[model samples]
Target: MARPAVTLDNYDDVYRYYLDHRQNLLSARIAYAALSARFRPRVHYADGARERLQALLASGTRLIVVANHLTDRDQYTLAATAWQTPLRSVIGRTRVLAKDELFTDPRLRRAIDLMGSIPVFRSQNHGLRAVADAGRRMMDVSAQRLQRGDVLAIFPEGTCNDGDPRRIQRLNTGVGHIAVKARKLGAPPALLALGIAYGPDPSVRGSADVYVGDPVLELPTTPMDITRAVAEQLQAAVDDVRAVR
Candidate 1:
């Protein structure tokens, strides 16, 4: 499979085209159903979190959902729950923030694109200046999508926590930058924190539980502030689920 050519000059257009052309409600629904049937995961939530999420859904408010990066199946778990919950209305319109390498595989790329995924190239592999430039462009695209009333799901930890599922790793400020820039675009998306954990029952196919936190409506002024705020909120939420587990 020939991967899509991505250059800084055309990044925004390419991403918008991918998102516009790939999102499919029917496919998302089917994928959700298939994953749910296969995993039979049990979803949990923080008090009043569901009602808040539902309200946001009803109002059609744009959102940036930040969550822990657990197993490869975490995306499927969230997708299944979203369809089953009030978020069902926004399922087709939500764009997941994913690493660029995930798009290299034809099969994985197809599945995620159908689920409305936007790619982020890791400029850290090149140099600090490159990282800064790439990060800005990525956030610009994210802001554009949010301003257009699209939902975004990102793992602020930037990668899976191989050390411990309950403990959130250090988060980068990319998630914060995206939110701040989106606000500048007049979107000011609501931030929702999520925590996902897999159950221990071997008899059951990895029962996963998702805990939702209240939406962070007040976005901080700086990227560092946003990063710290999200890190604290997500950590608390994940710990909440872990406490019950």
Candidate 2:
């Protein structure tokens, strides 16, 4: 069945709707179950990082999860990883940063919304300067959600890598900006780098691996500086997971 078009007419309202941290746990659990049934991925983490992450989640601390973008299915795989691992406790407390075009499909939007996702309009999509407003809204909303204690997951690379799975593409500073702004707004969340790797098949039933890095406590003052630091950390994590096979 064809899904209906996005009904929200006003861009402002649409952005707000996407920013809302509404987590439908029932729906999330169902989706997680489905993804788990399909993938059943193996999860890994840096030494002692898993226990530390679990402790943080147990303490109700909000986190910024950054990862490399390899394929479209990364979102589902992450969701399933969270469901199967200690990150399960954070399932309802996290908000995923997603591209705006994804919201155009009502059915997919509903599922993503249930999983607590915020829409992002990349500058490259609608002309670099033209979508500045949308980009700002995404950052503002993401910062606000972070301030509100919602864990935000972002793909700093912005787009998926089709060539070399090991090499990371240039990262977008939006994630860094959001983190800095969130701190200024009185909600400095911890940063965690997540690395996801899929088998050669790259299908739902393919073997997968997830690597979680240690929380980055020393963030740079400037957004660009922090973005660079985060990019390096994320790349290291990705390298770790990619070598698992």
- Best candidate according to lDDT: 2
TM per candidate:
0.88, 0.92
- Candidate 1 CA-lDDT value: 0.77
Q: Which candidate comes out best when scored by TM-score?
A: 2
Stretches of candidate 1 above 4 Å error? Answer: 1-3, 6-13, 123-131, 200-204
Model 1 worst lDDT window (10 residues): 1-10
The pairs that clash in candidate 1 are none
| Model 2 lDDT per residue over 2-80, tens place | 3323332344666666566466777777877787778787888788998888888787666788888999988988887
Cα lDDT tens digits, model 1, 150-229, are 88889888777789777899998888888888888888888888888887642357577777777877878888998999
